[model samples]
Target chain A: MQNDIILEATGLTKEFLGFVAVKDVNLRVRRHSIHALIGPNGAGKTTCFNLLTHFLVPTSGRIRFNGVDITGRSPAAIARMGLVRSFQISAVFPHLTVRDNVRVALQRPLRNSFQFWRSDSMLDRLNDRALALIEAVGLAPYAGLPAVELPYGRKRALEIATTLALEPEMLLLDEPMAGLAHEDIDRIAQLIRKVAADRTVLMVEHNMSVVADLSDTITVLARGEKLAEGPYAEVSKHPQVIEAYVGTGHG
Target chain B: MSTRNVGFLLLAVALVAPWVAYPVFLMTALCFALFACAFNLLIGYAGLMSFGHAMFFGLAGYVCGHAIKVWGWPPELAMLGGALAAGALGVVTGALAIRRQGIYFAMITLAFSQMVYFFCLQAPFTGGEDGLQGIPRSPMLGGLLPVHNDMVLYYVVLAIFLFGFGAIYRIIHSPFGQVLKAIRENEQRAVSLGYNADRYKLVAFILSATLAGLAGSLKAVVMQFATLTDVTAAMSGEVVLMALVGGIGTIFGPVVGAVIIITMQNYLAATGEWVLVIQGVIFVAIVLAFRKGIVGEIADRWRAYSAGSRK
Candidate 1:
């Protein structure tokens, strides 16, 4: 079980000035599992997620990924190591076409991003792969359209496609279904499950149904501390988890 | 029209402009046009608004003027020296300026450029108030062709302009350009995708400064003098105006903007301070009526028309 863990966090804590946003918490995500971090608003889930991705420095913690200590690494360095993250807000380059947005991500691992002298036509070689990613995200029809013009749901899909272009070993999605309509939520939930088949996914989400359907392991948090952790069937019935959710007025 | 057709048309117009227009005036416009185009590279594509670009432009002019006047270096070497000097300055300034974004970045650049301006005002080699005078246009092609003739010098400036402009066009269409645009549109997203956004911005800054230097060197050779005006903050504002009026992001926009502005300056020489008022009015009008700029607005309209026609 220890060897199966791809990402492990020990005693992770974050504080804003004097107020603690996330208390000492330990999280271990096994390889190829869809792990969900669910909490009501102000539950410190986003803070924990930000700390893990190094967007915010952990007040005190040790983060190990694939057996290497990764706490204090820059976000780009962490991403380069295949621990890519997606923003809660859809993060696509608005001026670039959907295909170009994915291509920009694809260029990162190739290490040819500084080749300014080469014609962009040289990037045409990535078109087949880029289009495949677009199709996978159900954005093939909008491949050539500027991402700024994309509808809200489609923009989120493009963000996922861009993140997937990195081909990460572990993916951290921050509220992957935030602002999504009901129909779009179902599509994205299905998309997330399909992508999770080959990779580890740790997500912070408020939508419990999506969590129950996709998460193999569920961790519940409230007021900056973990409340419960188990398979969804077991964790959903935990009295403390129910009380925390209900107490927060989210029941 | 297709981009290829536009390219051909521009090339044809450039080739024939010298015969129809005053060669000296045309050369002056070409030099400024290159300067504005280089300025546009940073502000338009990289989303960096550098307020001290004239430091590169004026400093390169001083370097090229000194090399030609005192060292008697060949014309091409002098220009290359100026460009390389400006590129090195870019690396130093860009490293500092890129640490801040938006208005702070602009302020830092402005401060650094002002320092350069003061240095130029007091530096012994720069001739202070008198400026570097009578910079000779030396012979080219191993002394086979002399640049003493205005027409010959015009061709040289035109060739340099085309080369510099073409280089910028190529960069904007390259994979590297795509990443810069990504950084411009959403820097945080670009970083999440593993791009070192600051490094890319620095490279772009250096490239823009190098090209600006190239234009400045050409201007020094053409005018046969490097003056304090070249390094002034006003020069920086002028380049920005050209880029904005022509179209901030469009390929040929700055060139068009430069020509219009330069021609206005030439014709309105007798208007004295009214010229400033006219320029301000034009800027205000551009901001209010067509914020995309002349070429940008035209391009947008063309796209809309084409889309409608297809429908």
Candidate 2:
């Protein structure tokens, strides 16, 4: 009775031209779970992420988030419904400072996103929250720095901080630990652990250690299809998942 | 100096300028400055490079001309009518153009602009090739103020330009401006943050178009004619040139750009058609020499110099 899944995708499929990119994949992300979607390089994990987040329309599938069908929603509308996705390559607003980047997300809830008539000083109220989120991701020192000037690893942190500012119910991270330094990886892992305390996290992560350490459930995909699903320990030992990774030299 | 002080200084300069310069020329440049500023709001702030903005400016001019000449409307009412008509056009064209990205967006806008131009060419109100001529410079606010005096009209034009420029300045610095910057910088990221990016883009496009219309309305009143030349594709390119030369994103960049380009064209008028050649050369030179634009480059240098001095 306690198992109320937050996101449910059934028969999700996507085709580009004549080739199928993501085929008949079903995924369910539970409430407040650290779910890691893992697979080899050519896996349809990215496509699947796009479909669930409404960044790409599924070729044929129904996606129900919070038990409501959200098949045709715009990405922004989907995000407003509390499902936010971070881009694969850090999606920081390059010209804006770290604080302003977070503020962009915080201002969404204000709904005056187009109050061009009013002065910007009204937005000063959001500064404290923006700064807090900046600090939450250990970006307080670089808070004044333009996001373009931030180091590669720090941009990822800023991206997460911005997503956090939205107070999303579910945060879908596309390759969160992709290009981080070893130290950054651990810190981000800690941050993810902290973030998942109150919200659901469904991340497509390449780092197996982070996957093993953080995920409550792991879903593996290979060649545009779900190969296996379960806890990391159990799925890592699955013959198909092992063959999928080892077969592609991602072992 | 603070932005507030700078704004006041610019205002003082504008007030004093018409006395020193030719009032007609000054008013003309002021109208174009406002036009360029409105254009910059899209390209500079919103990162929407619209190549069809002449549609708004020219359309408003014709509308204002018709209102004043045919309807016998006051200048104030005519200007308002022109700007509102342009704003309405923006709503339609903006909805069509904002969804597209990069070149496609530019093309859509340009196409819409061409459509507007053709409409103006055939529309009985525009007088086709002859243009709407001998338009009277009407009084302001139903005889509250006389604007028939060239000098008085100069001030009126200055006021209109200032209002438009101030509105643009406020928009850029507002919460809405912050969101526009976000959308401009990374649209996908903005959307991911629950921003309806297209809606914001459409709003920005409309604002730009409306302000451009205001500029056109002012120009028609000041010049006493709404010509086919005003609505041409080349006019659209001229605004872009002004913004690029002055400073694409910086306040007062487009004004400076408009002044410089307009002055050059006025002075080079003796060169006949070669004035266009000189403009093209300057545009290319500016583009090549200062990629960040004149104001942007100067600001960068100033920052570096001040930082060095501090050291």
Candidate 3:
């Protein structure tokens, strides 16, 4: 039923200087699900993520989220609608304390964006919630640290905490497990599992083990076209996916 | 110790200093301090370099001058009118200027400000060569205080300066201010996290311009005159120098820069054209050796030494 759709893209196309990055693509993300988008490099996965989240306007096609058409919306508007994205890079206010970073993220949804007239104590309650999110993400110890001063892995955790503060119904994570050490990836995988308990998480991951372990559903693409879609075990054995990954030796 | 403690100490000194210093000189420093602090809002906190801010300053001055002289408006109303007009101008100019980024943004604002300067030059109300002269200083708010008393006017200017400076400090500490700093540090990251960076920038621009206008409007009242010279590119350069010399990002730096520069200007009033040369050298020195300026360098030193001692 249409009610199951959290996000849907129909006939989406993207081009850069006449070079086709995505062509005649269709995708859908179901409600309250962990959907993994896996592909080789230049598979247009990142471009697709950008298009769906309103970071980049599609050349043509329509995107609907939460049963409403969201084409041509600003990223901020889309996010305000409870659709949020964490960047491939650490997307945090590095100069601010971790608690402040989460508070800034929460400020948008709280409609406290321009409350310059209000006293600081009125906002302390918001920081308490931010601290709770920080603790849930195991960042309680680093909560007072400036985002930039924290270790690399901690910054990523802070980014997740900040994103969660937006109270998104759906989260688009771009390479959440990338560049993480094996042990750190396990921790991040556990965090993603915890986050996924409440919200729909659509993540683009290169790590096959993470994709296998966390995803309820997996979609594989090679060269901008859908190769296969299923649970992880089925897709891992798909001939085209195996051929794509085996020959490239990069993903 | 803490900058807040130091700020309070300075505030106390400023409140009591009319006995020791010339009222005119003290008032000039106060006006310049407010102006510098307002200018720092965009550059220091928002990471926006607005080369066209002098347009706001000059426009407000001219508007206040016209309102007082032609419309015969009260002093408070005239200053408010000036600030409102400048805020309106800021909205338009900021929308256009913010379409560009980095050095291009700076150039766009500079170009737009220069347009305001040319408009003032040809506009008939500005009085062209002589400017609006022999302008009367209106009475204090609601005609409560006599206009002719020097120390009373000095205190009024100081109060306004303090109010403006306090507003800036509060804004910087607010959540909105933190987001602005985030946008300044990494705009793409801010966008990815769902902030409308352009909107934040425009709001900051308007706020900065309106406050700068308030400074100019007060200046017109203090000097009891408005001139084309106030809107000139040199005035723009001078405010930037003050911010740079005091500290580009710190709260107290610009005020320090403004006070020091005003003091220098008074002492060098007897010398011909030396103030400009001296200020220019200070700018070079700030950019070259003291990129943090007087306040930033001191703050950095204190932070570093404190951390070191704690360790």
Candidate 4:
């Protein structure tokens, strides 16, 4: 069972100018499970996500992916190791067309991203896959449009499509439904479920119903500390979890 | 018109330019145009505003001049040597400059260029304030074609410009160029997608510096002199202005910009200090009235019109 743990963090802590943002937190994500990290605002969900992806270094901790230490690896390095993250702000290349944005991501795994001498037509081979990913994210209609012109929901879809192009083994989605309307939330939730079919997924989401529906395992945080960990059926009924959510006005 | 047709039309115009205009003047404009195009690769495509690109242009001119005058290297070899030197300098400067981004990157490049300027000012080989003068235009292909004549030199300069410009065009349309654009649009997004944005930027810087060096080397041969004015900070500002006026992100924007600015300089030569004031006014007007630059504005309007027609 221990070998089944794909990504493990032990005693993760982050301090900013003598103020602790995340403190002595441990997290274990099992192979092919959808894990959710949910909490009220300023509960250090984003900070914890950054630490795992190496956007922010943990003050003291060890992170292991596939049983190898990646505590100090860069975001790019960790991403290359198949732990890709989507930004909370919908990190799509705004100036690029939807097809081009996906193609850029697909180019990374080909290891020819530095080959400046070759024509971009060489990457036309990726068009089929890129188009498929775009369609999967329901952005086929906007494939030719620059990402900047995409509606907010479609832009998030494009971001997911680009991230999917990386073929990551585990994905970290930071607030994947942030700022989404009800219909968009449903669509994106479905997209996330479809993508998680063959990979582990770790997410920080504020939407409780989405988290309840999608997460296979849930970890609740409060003020940078882990408050509860279990399935939604068990964790939702915990007294402290109820008190924390209600007290923090998250209810 | 199709993009390919537009490109062919531009190429045809360039082919006939030297015949219609003064060959020497046309060659000089082409040289500056190539220089501006090289500068555009960094600022326009890669989103790096190097405030000291003159270091590459000026230093390469000095090196090419030295190679021609002292070492008596062939014209091709001399220009190659100069471009290589500039590429080497780019590696050093880019490594340091890419450590910081945005305004800091610009400042670092500017500081490095200033240092090179002072070095050129005092260096024995650079001829101090007098510059490297009387550089001979050697014959090409082992004396198969003499380049002392302005007509013959124009062809040579034209060939070199086309090669450099074609290479830049190829680079911008490559998969690597796609990644560069992605980096420009969202560096963090590029990084998360497993790209080392700094490394990409450094490669772009080297390519740009090498091409700028090629332009400078050609300019030295055309004019038969490498002067301190080539290396000055003002030259850097001029390239920026050219890119801005033409359209920083457009393929032919810098070339158009170089043509306009160089033509203005030629026409306003008698106006002395007024040339600088007029350039300032043009810059202000372009920034306020046509923020997308001349070519960019035209491109936008063309797209809008075409879209409307489709409807």
Candidate 5:
């Protein structure tokens, strides 16, 4: 394992009754790099994210973040430690203005949790930071709009901005470009590059082109077990990864 | 109309309404206004449906009644004492009840409130069926002036109602309140945002319950008694009806709902059980035919019209 490792999972396992959703999986994420996890449907990509982020406790295995043993910690605790995940669904307060949504997300890191009486100006600096991020993700035009009224693609972009507001050292993005238009995919792909410049990025994506374009390394899973792990070019040509993709196409 | 402006207008009308009508009726409206507004805090903003608010209300009344009649404390101190006591209960109950979400949360709170009701019925301090009677209102602060004057008491209650309403207004606009709204929309996301969502919800519940306690304690002082009527499940149902009829989520909706219901109760006092049946019909009508209630429907229509015209 590298000394600069940001996230490490060793023998991570999860089971629902008799069914094993994820079993004996090992993942290592380096600091300041985009690592993509690709797999077929129901191949436990999401379950792995859930286990790593503590949204779901592992039936067995261990997760380490920034050298801390965070296997059984709550989601809130893990997030506070700068490990955050963006949802597959847009997770935002639809009734709140977009600016307020990001502002609240930033407020958590400032240690001002109970200062309800302070004016928004106390958060003016944070709001500025959020606005800059919103613009960075191509959402400046919808800054004042309620999140619910935004188009689906825009909402997904907003979710990324909100997650970034948490100031995480590592981001676990679950299918960030799953249902976006091609142009939007290119736009978010660029945004992901800008984000990966300063943070460790581990993403679950089904878009093979995006995986090949963005990932410094790729890990492929089939039936809750690692089939291949290497550079994107290397993994794409690997016999096991190719067979998993092709076999599933025929199966 | 905006909620703050509507709330102010109602306060203006309430302050003077007593001059033309019976003092007791106006006072009754004021108490229920605070009650409804407090209940609205939980339902409207936090997206919590508490069918057990009357537990805080009646529990505060019982505490106030005991302090005044048995402990012989003055009225202001008595009410303050009751508010604090009820706030403590709110924290404990909220801590437990907020563990569940949606309908499960509602059922947990309602079940806990029923236990409180049974405690009141059998508790010696509650005076059972007879309740605590012949309680004194005394004077404000330290009997600085006579409270026997109904007009003076009316102004006192009005001031408290406005203060509570203003507090609710401030909270909903505050960042903490925004987080509560976030939790209501999506708990999983709020948690991932590093918010202790459960702690925020519990705080909201305690604040609402404490204010509801203030209303209940004031009622005990005004009426000079605490009775089983205050603690009954029917009182809980009535407040929920008020929130539903006015608009569950809007700030002023509860006050509007309360005034309407109180006025109806006063005029139809002679109608016997038909009053219960009539109220039920209104609740059903509001839920089935007009899901937005009075204020919500108007707001929705206004938003639609504005959006359409802008296009």
Candidate 6:
């Protein structure tokens, strides 16, 4: 496999009040590869994701995305540059219809989303594309239903569908399989694989089996630092990595 | 009945309302209705609530009253000037207030409007407590009807109200409006989707403020006077009350809300100090019984019934 780094973070650290949530972590996400960040509870997995996505300002660090320095950039600007992050919790627009939720994600491409004079019927042009996205996520049956009305697993699908609608070059999935049931997990794993086919994915997942199955490289974070990094087979066998998980009585 | 059909029925009532009822009273309700609707656009659809909305409403009244009295400008031009003035103010205040969220945002707007209220008090053109009086009502469509006729003035105010209402309706149904709803639902998710949520918010703020200014200008022209009452903090609360009584997010809720509230105040004048106590009781009763406001409750029931019938 061609190993070109698509996203690189150097010495990323974040301090909240006086507490250091994330400390001196360097990460390299490969081009068109699945990179997983996993750790037990209180390991700063979500904080690290926020720092990389510029949602949280780092106390000290540098981040280069596709070779461009993106530190201190606005979240919206980072997203426009094709680095999109999904929330760890289900974050679909609850009151909007499933199709309308997808359509909102499509709005970022337009130069202006502020034509207050025109009727929404003019947006029929986007209906086909929005419907296509909804179908891909297995949410076609619930297209007209309000997102809040969907079952939890279906809401996750809608959230991912909304994220995918942005057509990001690098997708950051924060615990994509965090709350899924057994059947839902398999479908999401399949969807993730399908989406990561032509794009890079960096995910923070706690599901060990999922981490083992889907990751090209697993970066094990323990107590705000990288404990080990490599293929899941090699990293899983690392002495300190094993000790960190076992000592903490983790899953 | 469909919302569209209900809308048509309301329109029919408004057309002949002046002939049957007191024209001035109907015109006053229409102005307040437009004001409440403009206020609703921010709080209802955009999830923004400004406690200082009277700043926009009052400033436009001052500007419109001044223009008619001093510049000798026609009615249309005065209203346009008033709306543009409010829009300009919106741009300045919205840019600053959107820096914070929730209560901070509300406080920022309230602070800005408090400053504006004091400015209007001391400003030479505002006439301070007396306000700008004798704002002449110009001929509708350049002498299309008698300028002195309350019916003609009624039609002009109605035209302005319809225009504002139509614009707001278009905004609420447009692609832009959908984005606002998205932001309202989850601002963080909206931002992550590459929307400069602040920009959308500022645009909505400006639009809402401009329509509110139009309402204020109409009130000045109708009453032939723009008083300090229009710009007071109490006026802001009154608009919010109207929205709550009608339904915060429903389109026609503001109109229904404004009419009911205004009618209560107007007809209850005989009781003097008891009017306030009576209005309070009635308001509490409506809020307690109809949590969604009248139209919102009615709309919800209608939706549930229709869905049940289909099943």
Candidate 4, residues B1-311, lDDT tens digits: the string is 56678778988998888789999889989999999999999999999999999999999999999999999999899999999999999999999999999999999999999999999999989999999999998887799879998888888888899999999998999888999999999999999988988899999999999999999999998999999999999999999999999999898899999999999999999999999999999999999999989989988899899999999
Candidate 3, B22-70: lDDT as tens digits: 8888887888888899999999989988777889998898898899988
How well does each candidate reproduce the native contacts, as fnat? 0.85, 0.98, 0.43, 0.85, 0.52, 0.89
CAPRI-style class, candidate 4 = high
Over the stretch A130-229, how does candidate 2's per-residue lDDT look in tens digits?
9999998999999888999999899999999999998999999999998889999999999999999999999999999999999999999988999999
Per-residue alpha-carbon lDDT of model 5 for A173-237, expressed as tens digits? 99999789888899889989998899999999999999999999899988899889989989988
Model 4 Cα displacement at B117 (Å)? 0.7
Better of 1 and 6 by lDDT: 1
Measured against the native two-chain assembly using Cα atoms, what DockQ does each of the candidate structures obtain, in the order listed? 0.84, 0.92, 0.47, 0.85, 0.61, 0.85
- List TM-score (chain A only) for every prediction: 0.96, 0.97, 0.95, 0.97, 0.94, 0.96
Could you give the CAPRI-style class of model 1? Answer: high
User: CA shift at B147, candidate 4, in angstroms?
Assistant: 0.7
Docking class of 3: acceptable
Candidate 2's error at B143, in angstroms? 2.0
Better of 3 and 5 by DockQ: 5
Error of 1 at B233 (Å): 1.5
lDDT of 1 by residue, B57-153 (tens): 9999999999989999988999999998899999999999999999999999999999999999999999999999999889976787678998888
The Cα local distance difference test for each model comes to: 0.92, 0.92, 0.86, 0.93, 0.87, 0.91
- lDDT string, candidate 2, B1-311, tens digits: 55577678988988998879899999999999999999999999999999999999999999999999999999888998999899999999999898798999999999999999999999999999889998898788777678989888888888788889989999998999999999999998998888888888899999999999999999999999999988989998899899999999999789889999999988899999999998889889999999878878888888888889999
Per-residue accuracy of model 6 over B178-248 as CA lDDT, tens digit each: 89999999999999999989999999999999999999988888998988888888888899899999999
Model 4 chain A poorest 10 in a row by lDDT:
A242-251
Better of 1 and 5 by TM-score: 1
Report backbone clashes per prediction.
Answer: 0, 0, 0, 0, 1, 0
Q: Write the per-residue lDDT of candidate 3 for residues A28-137, one digit (tens) a residue.
A: 88899999998999998999899988788899999999779999988878887888898887677888888888877777666666655455565687878989999988
The superposed Cα distance between candidate 5 and the true structure at residue B111, in angstroms, equals 1.2
The runs of at least 3 residues in candidate 1 whose Cα sits more than 4 Å from the true structure, single-residue gaps closed, are A248-251
Q: For candidate 2, give the lDDT of residue A244.
A: 77
lDDT of 4 by residue, A1-251 (tens): 78899999999999999999999999999999999998888999999999999999899999999999999988889999999999999898998999999999999888887888989999999999999999999899889999999989999999999998999999999999999989999999999999999999999999999999999999999889999999999899988888877874654
